[model samples]
Target: MPVPCIILASPRLRKTRWPRLVVVALFFVTNCMWAKGPAPATRIPLDPLGFQPPLAQFMLAGSSMLTVDYVDSDHLLLTYSTKKLLKRLSDCPPADQDRVVDGVLLELPSGKVLARTSWRTHDHGQYLWNLGRGRFMLRIRNTLTTFAPMVNLAKGDAFAQRPFIRTERRIGGVLLSPDADLMILETMDPRPSDQVLGDQPREEDKPVQINFFRLISLNGADIDVHASGALRSRVTGRIPANSAGYIAILDDGRQHWSFDFRSYGGKIKELAAFDSTCRPSPMLVSRSEFIAFGCHLSHTPQILGAFNLRGEEMWEQTMTENYVSPSFSYAPGSGRFAMSRVLTRSSLVDSDSFSPDMFGGQEITVYQTDSGRQLLHVDAAPIARAGQNFSLSPDGLSLAVVRSDALEVYRLPELTKEERKAVQMAEASAPQIDGDPSMVLSSGNGDSTGSPERSDPSTPPAGTREQPAPAAADASSSSASVAGSTPTPPAPVADAGPKAEAQTSSTSASQQAPAEQKPSDIQGDATPDQPRRPPTLYAPGEKHGNDPAHRDDPR
Candidate 1:
């Protein structure tokens, strides 16, 4: 607010006007003192729920961040950096040629390992929870280590047998979901080809063959096999690629298959046949979505995929490519789905973005499930690209993105005029300070306007005397010529130390006050009974957006 201009003149003694003049003078003094109540310090506005603190970056042993799993709410089972593990097991060369060292299971914070399982090198791990035997499988050297669930370290291993049961024959990917009394294990094993006839190798290899999917009850009961008996391999394989197939068990014990081509005559059902000879990556089945990896035929190859929840091939979208691979996370309540892509590259800019020869970049795509419309796409800025991940507010109106080693937040576009007004009002009501009104009434150097009444310097009133203004109010005030919109800069000071400190303190206080205020406080007042509610959480492994109907432009 602009400081109120004050004109302090000698108290006139006209009989009728005396009382009115005294009242006006008193009111001005009180208002001026209140207005000058110590200028507030400067502050920085920050989002409450929409801010992400940086996680300590530890370029772990392998080329990727250790895949983390929630053991419960308080603890996480992480395949963290294993240089130490590798150092200790240097003598134990990988039996299967996988470089990933069996990581020591360490309790977070304490960093105490309850047990150590044999290691292998792979990209991910899956936790298998059975009522009778709760275990997790870590895929490194193509070995499956089934260990007791470790929620608390102090409890020790629930039943320690090398901390896990090691499996052989190379299970590239595994999904364990039980239905009724049955527990199904679907592992992707690439098909082998035997005929190397003429120059038709590429065409021969292009034929889509189904991978082996095993259905065994955790309780070891009945076995139901489908298609042409069990799985067989053709011998013309060149590259070491895993088969692409996904298995999902609905609540009613109805098994859904996306890539089980045998049952569907080796044709495209929910899953599509390869666009090229390269075998597709293993399918990922999250709660309500199914995502199958797609391939690109370029130098710096790109990873693509399709998503579907209803297991219908009619609606599927070919997602934008990324450097590494795409992973899906959904908040059903907010009706927003996030496709997180990890960029293993050190550079932020896409190779192709600069040079046509270089054709790879990293990005995270967030889409609105209801409309299947992309809400935002954030490039993985190089500075903090490795560990930085995006987190969203519960309402989905704001997104918290961490990149470039700096935190950035963006408010979602408003859906209604009322919401826009509220946002504007909040910004306008932000705390602000103005210069002291008393400055306008003072003499050339801030001294009292009434110079005719000068008191002795030694016997000044209880408080210090004010300084006079710069010059006579008339000449300076008229020539000042204040601009209409642009603000007047503060008058320069001698030291600038105390003034700067005061400003800083005021800003800090204002910012801190808002920060301390909880989101609930603001939420209660503006709560609206929105008609359509979004989903709160999504199953991690289910494929989403695989249905062609969900795609903006079906391909």
Candidate 2:
């Protein structure tokens, strides 16, 4: 059965003379208004699970989460976030886990943190896959380097990094292809010195550059750098510091690009660069065509755009409201792309930049890829928000959105016209074998043997009686019924007339001959009684010895 919807209606307020009475009534109504939707499929944690309730069910610890990928049909990979705690302790607490504070690649099934090689600093994370050899291979990148790591969660197992020749100045985006043969990494202004700074460093001049890309092969560890002509930026030589561009991998394995304007259009030279986190996901369309979308913090207004592979402009899709720290994914079977938009409003007193305000927007918008039209929009205000990233199901039927506290699975409706047609065709062609058939049994008038009439809810109910039909009864009365059915031999002929007596005896003897030749048809070892033949009837004059009924009565 489908889950039932929960709706709570507000109660009416009556005019009262007593202030205490009114207060009490209002309080009662307020508590009742706390009704919520059904519990989510499961409860995976945003951080640790000890003091935290299942993030999917309730909002006690201020969490909102969504589904990512399914472990099977029941379990899921959920991405969630909450208010960061200011307190830290040197010694580990009993409930809280002592996580290794380093850039590491970890798998979900087993909590294994990969070791780093040569103190490689990580600014961005890419794809992760379990090699089925108790190790996980992940793609990590920084402004200057991109590398792959084979991490063994087990203590003794060694984690190794395989470096490829082509390194990006800025490795902003990473996508692992479905086939696991190739990965796409987006590159821009590469800062090789971000990781080289000591405890105290000297100031350096800002660099100006355009954005380009590279596609790396996991099988051969080869890189295909984008053509020189592909280097283009929304801002010519120097894009605003807060501005960002994204890369997407379509289902067909094609790569695409887009620009985000979170940093461009303000009095501030940079869009609060540190707090700004923009991670873009590549949804592969085919081997060649894909869609990539992200938010850009710019000196001007922020916007979302899509770039096709042939270097053609498809469309610039943007939200009406201001949103930053955007994450997106293309769902599997659904054919709809979902975007998680985190809206941050700046304080009136602080015009410096966009920061966390009392009121903001967190929404999941799904769009049709074919025409790029909006399909569904869901927003959870005050309760949930998402930042950084989110994931889609393998089949693309559902989307897992990250909330401030937990994850939420937005089950997209079947929207494709073709899919709807197919569903309709299947349902129309399905056999209705239980429906009425001509000449079949009908349950009425004491003789029909069909289904019962529809129950009348208005009528008083009583026990129902069932009886055999006339046709069935007639079929059971005669042995001729066996003629068309199985054949049973007639009992031995009794006192055959003299003219046919010899022929009849010959026939009986002939039948007995075959029976005698066939070693008792019963399989396995037979019981002693099975070997014996029937007793013979006595002749009228031969019955004299122990016949009590005849001896006592003189007939």
Candidate 3:
């Protein structure tokens, strides 16, 4: 930031003192503007947060940038909607438009609005979250209501109380645990027909669609389930493909489950048994990495990778477009993680289907969740869907974007003692894969695809910006089925706009047998958390309302 050069010098001969006028004005101001050549790329400095001109024009006219999180890093937790709930949020029904909602807490760099409030919400979108510092948690279905702002903001402290009763199971997700203590509630029953129908069924045959899992253990608003289970899928399966916390990858992605729900007493404990499988057109887990992508047919090729819950890989790649969505935001204790690349723009609607036009706009990259380095690279404009504009600051060093003109905030870049000694000398000359680098796959972009019994493994390497090349459109005219065989129906986007990314919507990344080459009576297994894949807030690929270990709707 240096530009003040004003050196005319004609009257100089009439005045040059012995100083030659401060050494020829410091050599034309160091080659005009403080000569610092070979340093041209720079754009991670934001810091907007203004909001006051009529509350920033009614917060960009309602639904206020749909939740710009972070309850600490100096407060920030906006959510707006009023103007008759933004004109009856699509055909009236919060009891006809006024169901109330408005929150503030702001504060950053003295853009002060410190506290403001209002609430009633029963699913309009983004149910709050951020349980560190001043506290925050709000969910609406499967009820969980917490808010503290240092304790008491018109009262709310019932973080969960639903002793199993939704008819035949109906809550599908409620996950938290990056240290919000622990949770993994799930309840699947209504999501069948991706059809596999083989390998042993017959309990009088067809009623299998169970997936109950419960493992709780929170505190503060108390919640203790400890263990609960039900996975009964006697054939007709389509991916235990991905799960989080007590880990699970089930049959299609081959198998990797790994649970330890607190030293086994109530039960849910199995670990180690990975390294194998490519059937990933979706597998995103968290609570110790797992990012799979593979599935774009023309005989497979998409590939992608990040692995290590023993499913190995570490970093592989390939995705020459097919609706590029790939998202991520995470900021737990700020070791950082951004990763975007949305671009859905697929348009078509019917003739076999294609969808993805959530206004289109992406291409991000924050990284350094370890050696993935690349501290901050930007590009966020297709407002409204795809990580809901942008947010990451639960101590990950600020970054709340809703840019068009205001509500910015970006301060996340640091680690230059020669870039942390070139990332600890490239994490000590790479090549460790699991246990070598792994805090869950980090040798970031030094690229590595060996080990795990090579055999090609679809090699592609080089990451940090997950799989950028985005600029989508041309899914080759939609409709396809062959991965788990029969699951083609993706094409609805006239409105399912907000709340996206912990993805799952494949063209099929087929080809299995990897969790240590499957089958062996495979018996139950799981990791620790699930229920948070909820913030792609619009589009990427998956539709799990989550992945904070909630995988897609952990609630």
Candidate 4:
């Protein structure tokens, strides 16, 4: 059954099914509005569980949080904890600790708690996975369980708990494929005497510990990872998680970079060596494309762009010094993805600079995964747990973000041709990356070489994305083009300063690839609150890019 588009919040509202004619008319009208321009976000009241709502502030370690996620487009799961102050003998009153943990299944707009139940511990968030369509897989302690609260709440206790595989080994982390067809369980145990190599003299070279990757098949039709069972005997470390259902062994080696991937129900295949300096991040790999962020280009704008699954640069864009890719949300169905930026307030100085290994973004921007068309730009209050405060629907039609006192629901609009053009052109011009694309850096080393040069938003870009023959066109062309995409050159991006390009190839694994696409850059609309980054000495086209960078670049 299709979820109703009703936004009325009255609890007494009755369910009314619209006739087919009315439904069609409503759809037509809504789309017409979207055709004109992206619609403003709809505001809805939010109900955090506790009085002192811990929605945005749950980031501190040992601090309680109110976690919220969508059960379906119209339903939400709000889990939170409450604590009581035990009578103190002395002066110390223990802080409000998360003592009683519980969850409420909320129906949006109406703000009704359909079902109420207790929840497992709030820690070890990695042990939980949203399996899509209201189902979730979670491992509490040594036991793993799967349940769907949306449908099962009416029949039994906290949805019917179906027991899955349980392992004795300590579960270190759990990851699900992008398609949610399989789960990779990383388990760890101490090094045993039998496994230890007594022949090795070096302590580091000897087996420090043992880690194993156990695969569980979530969907039988897709990759049969369980058939292979536990990967090898004892993995030296955690296996690379490929959400696109391509379980891979990445060799992020210094020179002659290469990696191997196993197709769904097929043999492992190796990719060609990458000579380019850009080392792609494997975090959000799809069957079609991957991302490369500042792999060593310090002088140029820190780049964030997509590439072919086999390691060809498709289209790229640059970001300001403060922009960080902390949270990533991709909708496999709609081919739209979102990334966030975070600015931390530090007591060390009055102004907040970008921090490493942090999760919080001042804005959450959504774009077409393939064409790189900028779809939606939203200003979000920085939350340490920014990942939880917002969610993109699986089908990619709607985006719900947690606001201070309300939930801002934004309907992702399908832009008309003119709108797509305006968005791309308004985003950024083609980026001019000079020098040899090849860069050398130590493994996990902080950067590729370049001076710390920041872009000024007030300046117009070098080029724009054109109508056709697009795949991130070179700046030399009036309209930058990417292969299998139309050219849409960039304009000055507000928050990002100077506009740049970000794009993808049309050849996605599951869907028929588009012939060509014009992509939008990571440039989201700037906000007044965000400080404009100061420009550095080394601008683009300067040789000897090896000069020390300004402190502004977020590594």
Q: After superposition, how far is residue 523 of candidate 3 from its true place, in Å?
A: 17
Query: 1 or 2: which has the higher TM-score?
Result: 2
Give the candidates in order of lDDT, highest first. Answer: 4, 3, 2, 1
The digit string of per-residue lDDT tens for model 1 on 258-332 reads 232111111112333224222233333222333444334532323344443333332235434333334443343
lDDT of 1: 0.29
TM-score of each: 0.34, 0.37, 0.25, 0.53
Q: What is the Cα-based TM-score of model 4? A: 0.53
Q: What is the lDDT of residue 367 in candidate 3?
A: 64
lDDT computed for candidate 3: 0.36
| lDDT of model 2, residue 377 | 55
Residue-wise lDDT of candidate 3 within 1-555, one digit each (tens)? 121223455545446554776766776786664333122121222233333222322221112235666666766666554433333345332222134556666667655665666666643334565545555656544344455563443354212222222223323344444444433333323323233323323322322222222223344432322222222221212121211222222222322322111111111222222223322333333344435454433333255555443334455655453333344566634345666654443421121222334324555666654345555555554333325457677656656665544566767655546645533443343222122101111211111122233221111233311221111001221111112221212111111112112211221111110111111111111222421110110111222333111111100
Model 2: per-residue Cα lDDT over 55-149, one tens digit each: 33122111222223332222343322222333465542233222111233333334233342222212212223322112233433332222323
- Positional deviation of residue 123's Cα in model 4 after best superposition, in angstroms: 3.6
Superior candidate under TM-score, 2 versus 4: 4
RMSD of each: 34.2, 38.0, 23.0, 20.0
Candidate rank order under TM-score: 4, 2, 1, 3
Model 3 regions lying over 4 Å from their true place: 1-66, 69-78, 81-123, 126-335, 338-368, 371-390, 393-413, 416-490, 493-543, 546-555
Candidate 1 structure, TM-score to reference? 0.34
Which one wins on TM-score?
A: 4
